[model samples]
Structure formats: structure tokens, C-alpha cells
Target chain A: MSKVRFGVIVFPGSNCDRDCYYVLKDLLQVKVDYIWHQEEKPKGFDCLILPGGFSYGDYLRCGAIARFSPVMEFVQDFAEQGGLVLGICNGFQILLECGLLPGAMLRNQGLKFVCQFIYVRVDNNQIPFTGAAQPGQVLQLPVKHNEGNYYVEEETLKEMKRRGQIVLRYSTKEGVVTREANPNGALDNIAGICNERKNVFGLMPHPENSSEPILGSQDGLLIFKSMLQYMEDGEFRYGGGEEFRYEEGREDDLDA
Target chain B: MKRVLVYVTPKKGILDPAGQATQRALQSLGYHEVEEVKIGKYIQLTIQDNNFSESSIKEMCSRLLANPVIEDYHYEVSDV
Candidate 1:
């Protein structure tokens, strides 16, 4: 198969462009390109990533202005046709602003930016990006953001739950998913979620930061590996596949 | 013209620790009489033509300005 093509977006205030670029190119050994936000179009990339940073200085809310960038027009089109899209931290907020994701990310409940490594449990493994994860598996990833609180309506939340679209959940040391363990107190302890089609995923955690053991953890590497596997297989399953879904209200020991 | 005021607040079950901290700070500064504080956003918008409707403004808020999940919105529109 040809080298997996990855595109990392660079906005004016985006500080993580190089970080994401290095991870995809050096760590994953994939063909990676950094696309400027102002570019009229981004071509020849299999996947698009909106990396973390304070875009437009986080004015008018975290991602409000950045959502209007020219690249998003193409992103919107790309995602509509089953292209893979990942949004981390501020990028997650941009996805919400653009309606690519169903929920919105608000300011941290504490009103201060929180930066640290967290244990996130893989909740849905049927999606193209998360297929490498085994259900109930926990991985440590870095999260640095001021606005990462995820919110969705009750009906939608229930539907997402029933549909197995939730990809990751914040886990306590005991491996219990709860709001108290969430860095930003997101709804249902949700750290990440995919669209109904399972092609697009938005999460607050920075998987690129944890993709290497030298960076403190290699837990996030599986996310990239999973995406690569999806590309190779050319199969994208919705609802993370029915076989991977755990029985309701199940709990297990946490490795964290 | 029609003017609308939209108030956006965090829904219950969602932590508002920032609002709590602000309330504590206000009390420390001798604003002891204050009962509570819930920090939220207030947006005022004006639409062209007197025939503009409240549902239109509500739709705008839902699509462009507000996220209806953890945020509940209430708006009142009046002729200006």
C-alpha cells in the first residue's frame, strides 16, 4: 500500500503543528504535510487533523473564528464524503463550532487551563480510528486545554450511548468512568466521541503527545495504528461493531 | 426592527466551579449580601425589519451562537 497521507493544519495561533507533524512523520513513518489554514485548498491527504493551540488567540471563544477558515470549507466537504478527521483540544472545539461533531466544548469548569496526562478508557473500538483498541482498555494521553468541557442534549446523549459512538471515557484510578475523574467534567465522563458514521472523531486529549514511550506513555500510539489499519483494510464500521460493546453497567480493574 | 436578548447558562449536572470560585471571591471582598452567582453569556441581537420573528432569532442562536446541550438558552424578542 502507498504511504498513508496525513495533513496537519496550521492556524495563526496553532502551536502544535510541528508537534503533530513530527509525530506522524517521524513516529508513524507516514507521509505527512503541514497545511496552512489560509490555503485555498489542501489536496492529496488521506486524513486531516486539527491540532491543539489557541487559534485566533482563542478570541470570541476557543474556536469560533477559526471555524470560518478557508480550509474548513474543504474539511466540511471531505468529512461529508467519509474522509477521516481528528480534532484535538482546540480542534475539538472547532469541530463543534462547525457542526462536524454533535456537541459543544465550553470553558473548563474551573475556568483555568488544565495540563496533565490522563487515563482514558477505550469505550468504542468499532470505528475506523479506534478499531485497534480493545474494549475496556485504558491508555494515558496528555490533555492541555482551557475549553474542553463537552456538552450535548439529553436525547442526543442517550442516542450516542445506544449507538456506541462514544469512543473514550475518562476513567478513575479504579477504572470507573465518572465525572469526578474528568479533567473538564464533560458529560458522561466522555473524553472522546465519533460521529454516527464513525469516520470523524473529536477528543480533548492529545494522542500525538503520548504516541511515544519517551514522552511518558505509548498508549496513544494505538490510535494512529488503528487509523493505519483502517486505511489498509478499507473498512469503516459504525457503532464500533456490535461485538465490542460491553454489557451495560460493566466495570473492570483499571491498569492506571 | 426587532431586538432579542439571549441568555446562555450551563445546564444542571454540569459543574460550574468557576462560578463558585467567583462567588467566593465576591464574598471575600465584602459583598456578603450576594446570594449566588452563575457566570453566563448575554447576547443582544437586532434583526432588520419590524416583521422579524422570535423563532428566527431562536434559530440563529441555536445554529450560530449557542450549543443547546450543556447550555440552555432563553430569548425574548421585542419590537424596537
Candidate 2:
């Protein structure tokens, strides 16, 4: 199998960019590059990862300002072309701001920054990012954010649930989904979700921070391994090969 | 110069943990009359253009001043 190239977007104040780059390039042994936010054009890569950090110092909201960066235009186009995009932590907020993902993030319900390891259950294993795990499998990942509480309208939540777009949920170590297990008080204990096309995914946890056993937990490595496996199996093409029908009414109509 | 005063707040149905926490803190300080507290952002933009119109300001608010999904914004324009 050819090397799966990955691109890690680096925005101003993105502290996790190096972590993601290190995991993908060194740990995962993949071809990875860093794409700065100021770059108007994105380099050709199989997958793009938006690493976490206080982009723009969390000005005017977590990702409101960073979403307008020049490179986001290319990222939007890339996702529209069915390119795989994964957003972690503040990156998740950017995805929400850019309309690449549904829902919004609010201040954590506890009114404080949460920085600790939490368990999340794999809600859907069929997606390209979670194919390495089984449904209901529990993975321990670290989350460090003050505004990680996810919110969505009731109707949209139902539609996402129906479409299996809810990819991960905060859960207990035993894989039991319970309210008490939710660290950030996200709606329905949702820790992560993907777009209708399932090509874009956003989650608040820092998967890269836990990708190595030296970090005390390598469970998060499964996500990166799953992406490589998907690419190796010829499930995704780096450049556009087959034109996919862009689903209508799936652009996260927030007004509803 | 024209002064644009923008106020951005979370939507009504959305949870505001900061506001809630502040409200609780206030209540603990003996301000029991506080019915509700919603925290938000106040931004002031000074525009040098005399031709600034309400539509243009509204466009600015919609585009950058606020996020329609989670926030709503209103603005007041005055000559300065």
C-alpha cells in the first residue's frame, strides 16, 4: 500500500499542531505536513487533521475568528470534494464555525476548563475514522477545553441519530453510556459526530495526546490506524476519482 | 466617524454556563432579586465612512460579529 499522506493545519495559537504532526509522521509512520492558516491554497494530501488549541486566543468564541482564515476556504472545498477531514478539540469548533459539521459548542456545563482523561464509546465503527474499533468499544482519550459542550437542535439531533452521524459518545470505562460519565455535559453525552456524508468528523477529545503508550494510553491510536487502514483498502482516493452526490439540506442549516 | 455598538449573546434556548455561574455567584452575595442573567459580548467599532448604512452594519454583524447558529447580535449606530 502506498503511504497515506496527512496534512495538519496550523493556526495561530494552535498548540496541538506539533502533537498531531508528531503522531501522524513519527508514531503512525505516515507522510504528514503542516499547513499554515495563512496559506490560501492547501497542498495535496489524502486526509486533513485540524489540531486543537486556543486559535486566535479564543477570541469572540472558540473558532469564530479562525474560521475566516484564508486556508479555511481550501479546507471547505476539500471537504466538499469528499476529502477526509478530522477536527479535534478547538479544531472541532472551527469545523462547526465553517459549517463543515453540525451543532455548536458552548462553555462546559461545569463552568470550568476540563483537563483530564475521559472515556468515549465508539458509536459507529463503519466510518473511516473508527473502523478499527467495534461499536460500543470504549477508548480513553484526554480532553482539555473550556467550551467543549456540544449543542444541536432537537430535530437536527434526531436526524443525525437516524443517519448514524453520532460517531462517539462520552461513556464509562465499561462502555456504558450514562449522564454521570459525561465530563463536559454535552447534549446526549455526544463527544463526537460526523457530517451526513461521513467524510468529515469533529470531536473535542485530544486523540493525538493519547496516541502513544508513553502518554499512558495508546487507545487513541486506533483512530489513526483506522484511517490508514481505510486508505490502504482503497476506500478513499487522494484526488477526486469518483464524483459523489453532495447531499442537499445537509449543510447544517442552523436556523432550523 | 460612526460608532457601531454591537451586542452578541447566546440564543435563548442554548445553555449559558458562564451566565448561570455568574448568576449563582450574585445570588450568593445577597442579590436575590436577580431573575435571570445572560452573559454576552459588547463590541464597539468605529467606522470612518460616512456612507455606512444599516444594511451594511447588519451584514457585518451577521457575517463576523456573530454566529447565527449559537449567537444573535444587535447593533446601534451613532455619529461620533
> How good is the docking of model 2, by CAPRI class?
high
For the predicted complex of model 2, DockQ is: 0.81
| Candidate 2 local lDDT, A1-256, one digit each (tens) | 2578999999999999999999887888889999999999876799999999999999888998999999999999999998889999999999999899988898899988999999998877778888878656899999999999999999998888878898899988997777878898899889999999998999999889998888979988988888888878887422212222325454321222
- Fnat of each candidate: 0.47, 0.82
For model 1 chain A, the run of ten residues with the poorest summed lDDT: A247-256
How many clashes does each candidate structure show, in the order listed? Answer: 1, 0
Docking quality tier of candidate 1?
acceptable
Best by lDDT: 2
- Against the unseen true structure, what C-alpha lDDT does each candidate score? 0.81, 0.87
Give me the candidate number with maximum TM-score.
2
Off by over 4 Å in 1: A236-242, A246-256, B1-15, B28-33, B42-80
Off by over 4 Å in 2: A236-256
lDDT of residue A221 for candidate 1: 79
Per-model DockQ against the true two-chain complex: 0.42, 0.81
